[model samples]
Target: MYTPPAFREDDTAVLHALMRAARLCNFVTATAEGLMATPLPLFLDEGEGEFGTLYGHLARANRQWQAPVLGEAMAIFMGPDAYVTPSWYAAKREHGKVVPTWNYVVVQASGPVEFFDDPARLREVVTRLTDLHERPRVEAWAVSDAPEAFVAAQLRGIVGLRMPVTRLMGKRKMSQNRSAEDRAGVAAGLRQGERASDHVVAELVAEEGAS
Candidate 1:
């Protein structure tokens, strides 16, 4: 992540919040054959290590788990992002020097990854992951809701992963580099967009601009 001082996000809590908002992440690793990536859901255990630990699972058929990682594995969590038009910059009117750019938030966590197929650990990981995503629903589902024999068979098809995070990098590019007036223009423009993510980025732009 190429982040300038104005756009860097270092607060641990903020980084975690962003990660949670991104329910799915791209997990990448380097292998002797090549680089491989899988889009999966991972939960953070903030108390596990200096930074935190990541827990998730991948299909047993996924070859990524079979290869030895050359270095560290990285999980990329992307938050709200939007394209910003040069027309939204105040400077565009004054000097016509502004160009289009993107505004977004992202976090990358990297660490050594351990893949395991133990039934007990895999069961726990699956239950926890299910609870995290289902807690908000009126009729939340649980691993126990299914037949024990079926659940056990299902677990056999996947492998659990544990990564004690050694590094965390976060970036929030929310028009922080623009002048206050320019940023305000961007917020106002995005606020009118149809997508829900656009409104979220608008709020972030307004808040960072005010700061």
Candidate 2:
């Protein structure tokens, strides 16, 4: 998260929006043995804490949950990114001093991590997570859609997590360090990229309009 002033994303609302849009996150923790990470689908409870709380789950057998990491958990959320070529910089033509770079958005959240295995809490967490991802679908599914015994058995194999986020670091590098003309060139180049992520970067550049 080495964000220069021109590329910093300090707005809480913007950070939360990026987190919500990022369906998957990398959850990392420190253990006596070593560092461990898991890619997980997480949901945010913005009203529950000063910054917010993260909710996710992992298999019961996953050693990551067994380790004591009450206050040393971090979740990384990555948004759209694009490669910036020197050709996209106006300075390249004037002085040929421009080099390639990357423009992207990311958020890192760290806080105390708590693990819960209680059946009731696990059930609630699972349902909430499912609803969050399924709400947009025509035939959304629910936890209760399965039989009681089946779902209960499934829950037994996993554990729920709650991380009360204490710090939030966000970075949005959208050609802010470039000259206005260079930034515009980068934006225009990204707008026509075949990758969907590049288009996203283009939109972010347009929104910021920073140089």
Best-performing candidate as measured by lDDT: 1
Give the alpha-carbon lDDT of every model: 0.95, 0.91
TM-score of 1: 0.98
lDDT for each residue of candidate 1 in 8-69, tens digit (9 for 90 to 100): 99998999999998999999999998999999999998889988899999999999999999
Total clashing pairs for each candidate: 0, 0
Give the per-residue lDDT of model 2 (tens digit) for 1-211: 6878987888888999999999899999998878889999999999989888999899999999998874479999999999988987889899998889998889999998999999999999999999999999999998889999999999999999999999999998888777788878888999889999999898878766752
Q: Candidate 1: which stretches are off by over 4 Å? A: none
Error of 2 at 163 (Å): 0.3
